[model samples]
Target: MVKCFETGAYVLNGREIVKDDAEAQAKLASMLGQSADKEAAKQGTMAYGVIQAHNHAEQGGLLKLKFDSLTAHDITYVGIIQTARASGMEKFPMPFVMTNCHNSLCAVGGTINEDDHKFALSAAQKYGGIYVPTNLAVIHSYNREMMAKPGNMILGSDSHTRYGALGTMAIGEGGGELAKQLLGKTYDLAKPEVIAVYLTGKPQPGVGPQDVALQIIGNVYNNGYVKNKVMEFIGDGIQNLSVDYRNGIDVMTTETTCLSSIWETDDQVKEYFLIHGREGDYKTLKPEAVAYYDGLVYVDLSAIKPTIAMPFHPSNIYTIEEFKANAAEIINYIEVEGRKQFDVPNLDINLRSKLRNGAFMVDQGIIAGCSGGTFENLTDAADIMRGGSTGNGTFTMSVYPGSQPINIELVRNGAMETFMSAGVIVREAFCGPCFGAGDTPANQEFSIRHATRNFPNREGSKPTDGQISYVALMDARSIAATAINGGKLTAATEIDVNFTRPKYTFNKSIYDFRVFNGIGKETPETELLMGPNIKDWPAMPNLTEDILLKVITYITDPVTTTDELIPSGETSSYRSNPIRLAEFTLGRKDPQFVPNAKVLQKLEVAREHGENPVELDASLAAIYDKIKSIDPEKVVDPKEIGIGSAVFANMPGDGSAREQAASCQKVLGTWANFAKQYATKRYRSNLINWGMLPFEVSGDPVFDKDDYVYIPNIRSAVLSGQPEIPAYVIGDEVKAFTVKLGSLSKEEREVIAAGCLINYYKVK
Candidate 1:
């Protein structure tokens, strides 16, 4: 269904794909004049126009993007506003929308979530920002309905903040990026390569947006085909899809590990804006004739089927038919993978046991959040459930609309009534199912969901607490088809079905009534209402001359997501309190990490108070005694040197773009991270913004837990713009290694030198 180009390809207005490298280059050379170069050809891309419009880079090849607007959810807005407030921001310079969708349920944190919501309203009032009330709309939904515009750029704190299908280029990053925009600082990076996603043929009936997205993810995710690159869609097939169909595919582009995505806009996209009462926001967008792309992914939409991503990850995918062929083998592999992901006694995370006769059974079905809760997906689901029932044999289903407007339309069209009559519960707009806050399945049960992610412990299963449930990602169509079968696994395409094809009529009344439109209004006198759970960030010190770090834990997993770094579900409520949130760092992946990191933090904290920490931690005393023989001056003073802990991973930072993944480590005295390479740019940015050195080491894991790594004159090396810094791994003997800081903008260096982004602004 999806074919990836290993080499560069020439996309002729997005449809034709040339497989050969030499032929593509020759064609490009012929199209351009004799003076044409690769640099100039890159400008022909549609992404270039939007990126260039937002770029403020002094020199070419680098981008200093100032997004037209910014957005965040309850899980992220507090930290972003807090950082901006600390960095001397009085008012929002652009439209900053704070949506309360992630923590809207407030089931766990006892009034903590509500406290954050009130604080967001006050911040929107005082800082001049927009605020969406709880259960009104998901974060991306609000952005799509109000904030997105053609040729405009948007930076969001959530990883899935993609709106490229509507001619808007949206990039999701960590809180530090949003905080940068709040303070009028540029988001700096080298120009990302644009890969052409050439689509052809319309999707067959029963194949939804999630299926197309899963096909793309299954093709590109494991191979790193489009990692950190823009996937520009331009093809004749775009006109065949509805705006919502395109949106469903575009939003899931984050799972492909692509930087962002954009598609050629047509009347359907224009109508999308018109329906939302923002016709003025629509504009024509397409690639230039004979545009050059870094690579290409040619997708035949007609070949796509109802897809399924089995337990533990979204990338671990297989078609429903393919899974049914080797269910036992796949289930056994997932069981083994789950064992490695979850470390607990008697934690039986088994899907093989769920298998009955030759069919797999699921206990729950959920179609919720940005990827699943679209009007088209739900309408088709209701059609499949019509005159049928999701039998009450321990099998249940829930549907959540993306926004109140969508919810109202569903009710008006009778889709809600059909769903409820079929035993599928219809619910309000919430992002709970996507991030493990609502509709969690029972222990040892299997759930087929249409949510965005299915990461370990993502389904609200605390594997460490002896609770484990499996979640497999499937399209809403297939999920409903399975629902009608009494949870017996079935593909929607195989089952004859008809879609209602509901014409969307957007209702703006909900936003006008309940939402607080505070953007562009000045109310600086409004006081911020702080709850007891809301706490100030801990004071961070300047980077020390010589940094001492102990390798606390080594992660051998091929990839480490932000969910593993800092768990979601219940842990999201503590994001406002840095110290409290830090306690959960590596809480799921490695339970020993917090204690080890906190023990290392004690030395740094003690030294800040002018106390010798060698007496508090005897292990540090032994390391210093070893350092004494190496130092010519024999000066290992606690004040001049910073003590911290580090984690070594093959590749870290996938999944969510949560800053807590980095900030939590910073609060616990993490001075640096040693990795082969970071999975996403946002993860590395989060580390740098929190004053943690993002070190890329080429060698294998030569050190273990409690092993010391000493980097001398590290601060000076960073300020001097040295790309590669020398460091030593000290055990009984010293081993030398070189760590590379891949790329750092001028301001990024300043952020590191001053200990953090906040301190950088304070010092400036």
Candidate 2:
């Protein structure tokens, strides 16, 4: 189990935790004072040191960094390069890597995924970038194997771009940020507070890294303990974990809504660097003797049991023992939550029916992706599943290696054969299972996976289409145990198994033969292959003087994830084309969103040509009449106004760091989002990059669907850095409300003024 301490905790070399600042100073004086160390406690953390090394500007305050490397998968790289090219990029300014994994399946749209891969390969040659071809490796795994350097920061388009345990500080952001890096623009952000994740005790034999990670995520996610900050790991339990175990734990830190992560480096980390053929990248990293943290998460690894995160989120967790003992109660709760998430009436997930003879059962089990497909987890899973059968029933199992290198080792070490003997389908390196592209269960089937998420339709069942399934995330060890138990849910600790640790040999030839590494070697004449589905972005107008937004969907969900805004599964193939992808905007959460926004967008499009034919509903006319009644002599001109739609969510932008969540909203004529608070920095950045006003409401609003909200002089207010804007909601009665446009960098403000990142760079 994990415990979160309130802000201002001091940890000393994995031993003692002192809450009193004066006593902590006394303890630090006892250690560092004797040595006459002059380093400030705030700057002594591994996270601070790493960020400081990469920050090329002034050595204090805000960060304007230039990352040493950048990465994007197929779902992102195409759009990023397109935007960079549109923004006058000649060649990649730094090391840019594009991997084809998310859209590698090519099962949905014929030739669309392969066309993207081909375009990426050609783009890499033309832009002096590196390319990992289809099924070679996932984005994060490839970067960890080749590009992660100690004390260097790497920015990626995918959200899980963390490599802290490998002695590198990596961040996952929207494609707009990566495009800025490609154009040699500095990444601007305020210096974030660092939280200490103090690990103690050792995990028991059957427990895996995912179990420990889920425990940490569950404790931090709901309470906002580490939101938009860095988590710096320093503790004695680091001595017990392998490099892979640390990596498994580190990658999932993104789920905690942290900005980035770092860990104290040890010999295992050094060996990891050496194994990846980057011995020079290995360096000892730790917090200084007098390091200070704004907050602390104390995790006793020994007490953590095999855990499972129930449907819809990673934070809804329970130990495997606790879940089985209360399956009926848990199922009832989950089924109720599912009805809200899916919006399907009478859609019940029957987990209790699977309980036969006092044992809970599942239809399928999966062990794949970066968290589950690592060498340690799979090897341990193979041990648990050895000499066992999955049985001839509805239950099935699939395992995917994280990379070709890991896949080679598994096959060479006979673990692959052992898993196959147990009727497990071992596949190539693909991220389909993690995001809903492959191995989707049947309707109403319950699947236990060790992938990154278990959100609604994350396994590919369409609830709106009367097909709803469930995915509960568990550790690979327990997943393997369940597979061997003939689909009955079983924790790994309940099974007696001994693992034969195998040494892995890294092979570079697999990548050399198939992968394209064209860094520093640009072929300018190369032509990019374009599929019919691949299209350029539509032109967007700048922010108008007066703006009008209609509240289309008023969502009351506490935390609306990016997946809910724009789904991940089949819609991923349409990301390259903004217009096509916009159709899926809020398709999962609010089915009527696109039509409503599209209707309002036509008015704005018509006004762009100075042809303002008044086409207003009676409700809209009442708002315009109210404005006219206020100042009839000035005359509110339609030519000077812009019409768009907006949404009101309690809290939005949680899960994935996909920019499409915001971009699709922009393309659909969404001008603003009213939320209590954003879930992550990446989501807010996405909104800013897409030119939407991220409005934070102070109190209850009198806004409803089809109601007009008018903001006068919005463009001037944005350019002048006005935090609060006077907005009026037009309903039966004209009521006014205030919306705060939180913190924004100068460049972010300019991006909003210029309409979007693409337009901002176009004019610059």
Question: Compared with the true structure, what per-residue lDDT tens digits does model 1 show for residues 1-764?
Answer: 89988887666556665554656556655654432355666788999999989998876656999999999999999999999899899999999999999988888779999999999999999999899999999998889888889899999999999999988899999998899899998888888999999889999999889899989998899989899999999888888999888999999999988899988999998888899999998899988766678888888999998889997888888999999999989888888877876656678766777889878888999999888898888999999999889986899999999999999889999999999999988888899888888988899988898889998888988888888888889999999899998899989988998787989999898899999988778599999999889987889888888989999978888888888899998888888999998999998878999898888788889888888887787666777777766666867775678888998888999989999999999998888899999999989999999999999989686677778998888998988889888887889887778888988887888898888888988877
Clashing pairs in 2: none
Question: Compared with the true structure, what per-residue lDDT tens digits does model 2 show for residues 4-56?
Answer: 87657655554567664545656656755642232456777888888777786
Candidate 2, residue 524: Cα displacement in angstroms equals: 1.8
lDDT of 2: 0.86
In model 1, state the lDDT of residue 610: 88
* Residue 254 error, candidate 1, Å: 0.5
* Every candidate's lDDT: 0.88, 0.86
Q: Clash totals for all models, in order?
A: 0, 0
Q: Which ten residues in a row have the lowest lDDT in candidate 1?
A: 28-37
- Stretches > 4 Å off in candidate 2: 13-15, 21-23, 26-39, 59-61, 616-619, 631-634
Model 1 has an lDDT value of 0.88
